[model samples]
Target: MARMLEISKLTIRNFFCLREFEISFQNRGLVLISGPNGSGKSSIYEAILWCLFNRTARQSRVDDVVNDIVKKDCQVIIDGYLNGKPLKVSRFRKHSVAGNDLVVVYDGENFKGSPSEIQLQLEKLVRADFNQFLLISSFIPERIRTFAAATPAQRLAILGGILDLHHFDMAYEYTRSRLKQYQVELASLEKEISVIERNLEGIKADIDYLERNKAKKKEEAEEEKHQLVLEKRRLIYRIKQVQKELERFQKGKAVDYEAEERKLKEERNELSSKLTQINGKLHSLRQQYHDLQQIEAKDYIGKPCPVCERPISKNLVHRLMQDHKRKMSVVSRQIKTAEEEKEEIENRINELQKRIEYLATEKLSQEKARIQYENELSNLRDKLSFVQNKIDSIEKDISTYDNLLKKRYKDLKKNRKEIDKLIEKQNELNHKIELYEIIKEMFGKKGIRFEYIRQVLQKLEEETQKILYVLSSSKLDLEIEVNNKEEIEIKVYRTGIKKRYEDCSSGEKHRIECALAFGLNRMARSFHLMSTNFLFLDELFDRALDVEGQEKVFEILQQMEREIETVFVVSHRPELQSQFSNVVVMRG
Candidate 1:
């Protein structure tokens, strides 16, 4: 059911040209607002918009919307009802800093809330927002036949928004996005699956290689054990030979290898000290260069040094930059020299390390030979038993290679397990991708909902043409044709002569606008897009109209007035007021 709007009072204070104005809209049937220019009739609509939306169509800047001549607070109030409920809306901007810039109070039924909450409740009641109200409910000044004269594509766009057809577009886009996301996920999974498969293959190859070489490794371990026995025997023989050679050492002096190593170490330490001193000097020079660069970067900050407290010339700045450059160059050279010296010292240390290792090896061998010489001379049986113990240790190492091979098998088993999991996930993603493809097909532009949109467009055209036939006095037939993509073109046949909407006369165009407005409003209600009980014409009939055109418009208005709950017409023609059941007169 369409809710009736009854304005018991409208108050405007210091807003636009309305210093302090109030009006009552309690009467019914054909409300006529007749006023001259600058009489603030239009401001009434502005006040309504403000009181409803906390905004006005007069300007975008709310702060400047107040009357400059008044230099005070601006306010407008529209007290009315929605569906038999008592509703009073008060919209005001304050005169003091303590108050708000815009205040909205909506008292309807049992709900009392803030402006935003009130607006939501209002949209629930009226079934439209501020912009939707202007499009479907209000017929404002200077836009009588505008919608019908617009291009067909442009018409579709406007109708689409009010009809909420963009929701279909949004749904289709959402489906497509999901489709892309699934496809990408599936592709990523496939790549990951491939990587796992490749890793699995590598593991299998390694296992196969290990299996193939297992026997070979066992054979090699046997051979290595035999070679180790030979090495042990050779060592035993060499020990006997070295014992005989060390008999000379027993008769000779003991050379101090440790003392010789210490002498080489002292030389390395002195060279390292020189290198450290050179590096330290280089570091200090580099730091000074960096400080100079930092100072030069902000050379404009001061003319002289803060420590010296003396004015310095530009020449001095240049000299300082040159000195910094020279210092950097010197530091670079010093770094190179220090690095070279360190490298030379490191090389000497490495030479000493090799010599020390060789000396230690020789000393160990000679000491062992000396010990063997003493032991064999004392007891040969104990020395032979020690060599036999050494041979048992080598055999234990050969047996451990089997454990290493088992570890390789364990790794292969782990890789295969991971591969199996990846394949399972891949299969699941593949099925999901298939389902997404079907979903994409269903939501594509030419898919399931496309025909529904076409049907709605067809209904709109039919309703518009039906209204046009009823409103227009001429023998006019309207047809709207569109391509598959929903591009529309309006073709009018007047006495079998065809013409576009742009080619129509002003009277014919006005009739088309009236038809479209009524049809669109009907469609809006039929589709439950938005709901409104009022239609307004703000200076819509003020344009130049001949007698016949005026009569046709009056007929259309009368027909529309009966269909709608309330129709407010703002005009300058007072004679037309007699045609209306209710009249409002405004005086400047």
Candidate 2:
């Protein structure tokens, strides 16, 4: 059941070369839109395209669609009915301002949405995209061969959108993506498993090596510890012996050599002082004796008085002489006594020096002995510390052997468990990889999508042949084939003689193009399950068609008029205008 799209009216203002054109498409049948060059015949349908989709086939830019004379304010309005509901589309651009100013009134209610949103709603209302309208519903002379001439990828993309096969593409991409992810995960797990296996092998070797050497290592540790103990005992005994020696050297009564030397020095100084005093007294006594001898040798009695420079009496002189002799005798006795005292003081000082020298020698010998004993004791203490450290290290080594083996066994068990888990995870990832690989193949372009294209081509071939039969004078048949390469091949057969599209004559190509357009329209109507009442043909019968060829094309349109509500055909031949009752002529 195909719903009908009945376009009632189209209004155009300042669009392209139209410049305020209006036409009523309601209740029309096989109408002729005859016009000379640049008379706005194509602009009429261009305006309708712009109103519905914000697009025109003639222009790339929206501003270019505005009429050159008017220079601004391009508007196109289309009033139509979709499934018996009123649908109105209005598109306006006042000098390209307000950004795609578009509105759609559907079922007598204004639909609120952006231009693109409303466009989507309109497309859904018609059950087709703009490409579908341009390719199937509207037949333009310049674009009639678009589907047949498109590259393989371009054709697939266009066909894919019209057929609504985006889900198949999505499924293919998603499955391939999941497959790749699973493969990467599986690779990582394989690498992890490899590392775990290597680690397990290493652990097994380590456990075996440890088991083989455990008893021997323990025996060696014990033997080493016993030797260290013996060495420690020997060091302790030597340290004790050195300590005794140090104590023995330290216990002697220490003599105060400095005090003894000080006392002896003081006594020697006192004796020397006494001797110096005795020598001084003897020297004075000698001087007095010499003076008395000199006085006796000289006759001072007859000389002037030595003290006063006056003549002196003999009796006075003789008394003075006697006094001098007595003084001399006293000085001689004093000199003898002083000499004896000086000799005694000298002997006492010599004894004190000898005693001080003896004390210094004894002090030096005792200091040397004390330093030797202290050095030996220090050396013994250092050796004892070293031996004690060795003993402690050996004991620690002996204690750790059992614990070391136990830890190795524990690590081996832990690594084995980890390897098992990794293997299990690796298995799980492998299963996922297999599943996704199958899923990827199922959704690929050569899989289910291939079948879909095959079915479409089959239906397309049938429809094209039916229309191509009426358009071709040589009983031409159209065959659209989808090969394994996913390439579409459109072939024309004339009584079983096949020919490529490009090999056809110009007039033949045009007829083929016309039939292909109608065939696609029929296919689209079937696919959408909707009847699109409007069909536009721009200069389909104007060129490359002789009189009989032209009549054949017109006959197809007349047959379509029975089913379609409006069929507007643009032509330059004035003779064909007489064949249609409803005709709109554009004179430029």
Candidate 3:
């Protein structure tokens, strides 16, 4: 059981769309302020918001808003009461004022405080900013639209502001950031896995190449070793052949051994005899030859005869000596032939010895070549073994790399799984965040507790639906419910079947809006009546409600007014023109 609050008077001078106006309130029944669209019906609400909160309904810049309404020098004054107490607040703009250049004043006898002090007191009473209390036409529509259109983050912010759930929003954001970090980490791990896999592929290629080349080199080395063995055996056989030939040469008869002996003895004897005989013959031939040399050709003929005294004729002596000389020349020719034969035999024997030596030396050279070849083969085999061992080690290393790569991939998969889980958790947190926002927006800070606010909203919705049904003559049984997430769902029960808001017609939608407004008005009236006894509604019946709906609203307002101290309905509706106690008509 509460009373109604009254506004004693309100004066405006160049304030918003209200150029110059003044209005007064009565603590009685309905008082309608009737006007056209631009006749400042809504300006009164904007002025109230500005006077109390130093802001406007449009959320425009303070300078632009002030300039649009107030002149260079003007002021706005609002006077009201809370349960028979004097309340006063004034705002003005001066020529020297630059930005938001408005002043506020408050004079209350109960709390003899300054304007700032009065503002603080009012804020405490309203439990919200003054601008927020006046839910203007544009404000309501904009809020509904924003709620429907904003992104999740924006929605969360708005909800946090409304519900004072900043902590929840912050926690949700932190969790989301952590989830993003984990996702990035997972991506990096995947990239590393790809790089490792590529490296493993390259290593495999190298291993394959090594295996092929190693096999080929091993085969070639073995073949060379076999060839070396065969060459060594052939060298051994050749050495044996040379050795046998050398032995035969060493054991065979020496050419000209006996003939050389005989030639030596005969030559020695002949040399001695020839020396003696030539010595005597040389003396005789010198004397005779000198005598023949001293003679002329004609004398030489007779000189030969002098050597042979038995023949006085030259021809006769010459012929006898020529015969003896011819016999000696024959003997000398035979001796020279024999000496040449002995020399030829000696030369042949020397040549055979040299040939034997050369064959033996060549055999030794072949053996040395075979030994070198064997050593080379042995060295090559050792190198090939070493290379094979290296290849094996490389293969083992490649295997280890493969295992390591597998491990890395496994770890990457594990990281990805962790990221996925974190993302899932993040999504859950996001849902919770959305839930918190919806709760806050529907209910204020006082209704921050989800379950309690949900119950209250449910009750409000139910009362609204009942009011709608009454207004609609029960042709529609409006059903209201609070969904799982605390959202309001309204259904029209027609023909024993429930139809959602979407299934309703335009007129029905208008009725729903009117019903909701009346329900809120009733709630506000009850709350305000606790300390006051007056309620004022401006343009409450602008919806396309029928005559029956209007009558139902009027009846409700009348009943509520009696319960409270007073009620004021401001509207231009012809149906409600005669229903109010007082009427004020404004024209541009």
Q: Name the best candidate (by lDDT).
A: 2
Candidate 1 Cα misplacement greater than 4 A, ranges: 1-10, 22-29, 58-64, 78-89, 94-100, 104-130, 141-144, 164-180, 215-453, 540-563
* TM-score of each candidate structure, all chains considered together: 0.59, 0.56, 0.44
Clashing pairs in 2: none
The numbered model that scores best in TM-score is: 1
Note the residue pairs that clash in candidate 1: none
What is the clash count for each candidate, in the order shown? 0, 0, 9
10 residues in a row with least lDDT, candidate 3: 130-139
Ranking by lDDT: 2, 1, 3
Model 1 per-residue lDDT tens digits across residues 1-588: 655455667888877777888876554557888878877777777788777776776655766657768767777777766666666766666654424333433443444566578667766766666766666667653343545666777766766666666777787788778878877887887788788778777767876776667667667767766776676676667667756666676665235655665776677677667767766765775676566556562473356677687876677777877776787777677667766776776777778778877777877877787786776644544545554554454454444445656776787778677768767777877787788677666666566556665676578778877767765664788876556576656788887799887888876776677666666666656665444456667765645456765676677677777777667788877778777778878785
- Candidate 3 — which pairs collide? 2-529, 3-529, 3-532, 3-533, 4-532, 4-533, 4-534, 5-533, 5-534
lDDT of 3 at 418: 64
Instruction: Write one digit per residue (lDDT tens) for candidate 2, span 1-588.
Output: 666777788888888888878899887888898877888888888887778777778754878887889888788888888888998888887745654488888898887787778778777777755666675567776665777777766666667776777878899889888888888888888888888788878877876877667667767867887877787788778778767765764664244666787899898888888878878887888887787777752586667887887877778778887887788778877777777777777777788878878777776776676676677667767766776777666666655655666787788788778878877888887888788777777778677788888888788788778888888865787888777777777777877899877888887888888887777777777775456678888878856888888889878888888877788888777888888899999875
TM-score of 3: 0.44
- The true-versus-predicted C-alpha distance at residue 117 of model 1, in Å, is 11
Better of 1 and 3 by lDDT: 1
The per-model lDDT (C-alpha) reads: 0.68, 0.77, 0.55
